[model samples]
Target: MTEFNEKQIDILQVAERLFAEKGFDGTSIRDISKEAKINIAMISYYFGSKEKLLEALIFSRTADLKIQLENLRNEAIPPMEKIDRLIEFYVHRINKNKCIYQILHFEFSSQKRSVDFKAFTEVKKSNLLSLEKIITEGQDLGIFKKNIVIALIPPTILGTYFHFNMNRPYYEEIFDLKTEQDYDNYIKTDLTKHIQQTIKALLVYEN
Candidate 1:
């Protein structure tokens, strides 16, 4: 992805937040301009259209994950460790970019697809394929069991996180979370461990 200028980045951030809060169809250039403190003409000048802007946002947000996956694939570490790190990376990324991830989750789940759905799915497919390659390598090395449903693996990880994220208020009470730092710590440590264990159980051979 090309480097985004400061204004472009600002617009993207505002757009992501609005799209997450108000659905892509609900948000307009005027809303973005109002929130971003910029003129609508500038958004047009930079991105041409709302669909193109969304496409850029999705690609830019996912570009690093793609590179990270590629790097992880070539690392000398054990495949299970790679999977663990991938899960950790995902948890951190989603937590950090909560709004963008929510927007992505909505885009994936919505029945009325957006114009940028193609770009979104492409990014999604690329990331899934990367994870699949790592899992396949593990199977080849006898580290993971064969006949695992590769398609289910991503949703298992993603859905779990989404459920926790979307129900944060309920979870806060259940977990007695009082502070922002407390919630972050809980998710990173306890929740992350649970996900790692679940995926390990699914992938590892049962004796």
Candidate 2:
């Protein structure tokens, strides 16, 4: 993971929150300065511009994910175990970085041309490719079913988690969750297991 000094980290965190709440286009350097209790000069000195700041935030958030995925790829484990681990990693990460994921989803869905968008797209593409490799390895071993669409797997896993996270309020109401902890528990336990099982079944299913 990339390391940042305290001031830069503060600015990035504030920018992430602002971007999540307002949006990339909606946020300004002044907004981040005010929220971070830092001056505009410091932000400019550290990050150069609002767009660069967004890039820094994306790099910071994605670096760990990239490393984790690489490590999973290298680990001496069965393909099925790797898939389960990937699912669990994503569930935990999405829950922990809800705001970051919100901004990422928004940015990608916008389909605009910019440095930040490109950087985010590259990171996402790398992750998807890593996932595809895992699936391909399984197929080579005759563990995963042939003719499975590798490209769709990432979207299926991430989209399901995103849908649940985005609609938490509705879920909370429907499930009668009385506390934030209750909802989190449900996700960590039931939701995680369901996703793992679903993916495993899809991988092993005979046509």
Candidate 3:
């Protein structure tokens, strides 16, 4: 990932917020300029085009996670513990960067195949390969089940989290979540645990 100056970072952050609130097509470069408190030329000078700006935002957001995932292969911990850490890190990242995740989730759900999405696909592919390596390590150690569907692992985690997030109002009503703190606690504890257990159920060996 390229290092962004403070000005460029501001633009990317504003763009992320707008893209999450309004669909990418609904947001214009002018809209970003207004929200970012910068001139159109500055944005153009920093990012060239709306698509390139989005591509940069996605790369910047996922860069740290990619590094962490790559490092997991070298960790001395057992593969299952590494898996747990991965879930924890992913959940934390998604919560901390909700807007970017929301935009990516929307783009994926809409199946947009623009050139920008090609960048997203590459990022996802890299993350998936990192996960596959962890799973293979577990399988080699005889802790994880063989022939697991690696492709489904990400959707399992991401899809479940996205579904819960998108339906927050409904779930809050059903669960009597009265405060933002309550909902957040549910996410950090209950929701995170559920995802960890679900993934373990898929990967861990039986008996």
Candidate 4:
């Protein structure tokens, strides 16, 4: 597990909230300072610059996710169980820290071509690695169908999170889900059920 100092987390918390609210370029150092209720010098002292603070958020989130995913990746679990656990982990993680999905989807949508993209790349690749391992193992053991959309599952699953978490305005207006409680019911009752059903459809079935 990666241990972040209190100061680092404080800086990241401010950055995540600001980035979610105002976006990357739209947010400024002074804004973070004021929101964080810390001196501007502390922001600079910890992260160096506003740009670097944003990058820190990206890196920190990905790194933390990578660690959690690894712990859940065990060969003993059935592929379907593995798959379900992964989905549960993602949903739980995002719900616990809205900023995880919020900041990630926020920056990714910007299309600014960040230098820290590789940090995200590693986390994604690690996740894909875990998925592929379980999938191939299932295939070898005759637990999963031979023809599976294994490669594309990564993007599709993660994309679902992005679609729902990032597109708040659309859901609020279209589905009348503006409050946290409404959104909670949506995720637990509908959104999570939807993702698992889709995953079942994607995996090849050979009976």
Candidate 5:
């Protein structure tokens, strides 16, 4: 018998879906409970409250990303390899956490912000430190073609990713996309490759 049960994970999944579709302001304990087919008290029992549940969701996602990045940081890889690993990790993580990303996009953009998403922030800071170190080391070994403009590197990488995943819906609206899968295919093959190449071109390839 496992200590954790499906009921608990179901509640979190339901909450995540609700948060994604309706935004945090529109999602409630009853909404989650009814969608999850669990009693409202079950959520409180498992995660304390809605606010705490949201925090747990953020922490869970960030912890996964932090682990992947930390593994790359420990490996004996060049900066280019690290960048490729980061891209792969981001794509996989985003695919796994699309609901959470949707929820975050809504809640952060809306005026009714409640909980502060501190979990990803810590992970992001740690990743930036590692990226800075990678850049410095690459420069020392003459593997890089530039100086210490490390501050621009992290945001450039992250911003390109966010643009692809988060900014796609509006683009889809402007264009005539058939389905989500179609959009995803376009991004995975064309957009992702372009972004990765652009990053390498901008940061590397001296003259």
Candidate 6:
């Protein structure tokens, strides 16, 4: 995440919430300025434009994840442990900031293309390549199955989380969740474990 001053952070936070609630197209710069209690010129001065602001928001949210993954590649830990940590990191982050998933889902599902989509795709590709390296290391050590398709792992982990997040409201309704904390607890515990186990199974299972 690019470091921002308090005011920039404030603007980004409000923008994220509005984007989650109203979506990118539905939201206006005026909406963000009003919600953030900042002048219109300030936002433009800080972020260039709404498109760049969205880009900054995505970078802010994902930069840490990218850093974490990069650090994992250098750690002396075993491959399985690295995988476990990766899963934990993603789950915990998503649990803390549900808006990241909301923005991703909205961007992917929208008919109109976002200028920042290409940047987002490049970020994903880099992360996936990093993951593939870890998986390949495991295969070399005969820990992960040789037949495992490295490309599929990222999508499997990400897709599962995204699917659950997009359908969270339905799940909450079905399960009769009365509070946000209740739902967060369920994701932090149950969903995290499920994804970890599923990924491990895919990596180590015999055909």
Cα lDDT tens digits, model 2, 99-197, are: 887787676677664655566668778888888888889999999998888777767877888888778899899988889899999999888998999
Candidate 6 per-residue lDDT, tens place, 47-156, comes to 99888899888877877788889999889999999998989887887767788677876677877765656666677788888888899899999999988887887778
Ranking of predictions according to lDDT: 3, 1, 6, 2, 4, 5
Better of 2 and 4 by TM-score: 2
- Candidate 1, residues 23-124, lDDT tens digits: the string is 899999999999999899999999999988988888778778777888888899999999999999888877887877777766668777555556657767
Root-mean-square deviation of every model: 2.1, 2.2, 2.1, 3.2, 3.7, 2.2
Model 6 TM-score on a 0 to 1 scale: 0.88
Q: What C-alpha lDDT does candidate 5 achieve relative to the native structure?
A: 0.73
Q: Pick the candidate with the highest lDDT.
A: 3
Which should have the higher lDDT, number 1 or number 4? Answer: 1
Q: Give candidate 1 misplaced runs (Cα > 4 Å).
A: 109-113
lDDT (Cα, tens digit) per residue for candidate 4, span 142-198: 777887767788667668866887787887778899798998888866788788878
Question: What lDDT does each candidate get?
Answer: 0.86, 0.84, 0.87, 0.75, 0.73, 0.85
Comparison by TM-score, 1 against 4, better one: 1
Model 1 error, position 90 (Å): 1.2
Which one wins by lDDT: 3 or 4?
3
List of clashing residue pairs for candidate 2: none
- TM-scores vs. true structure, each candidate: 0.89, 0.89, 0.90, 0.81, 0.79, 0.88
At residue 162, give the lDDT of candidate 1. 84
Highest TM-score: give the candidate number. Answer: 3
Query: In candidate 6, what residue range of length 10 has the lowest lDDT sum?
Result: 113-122
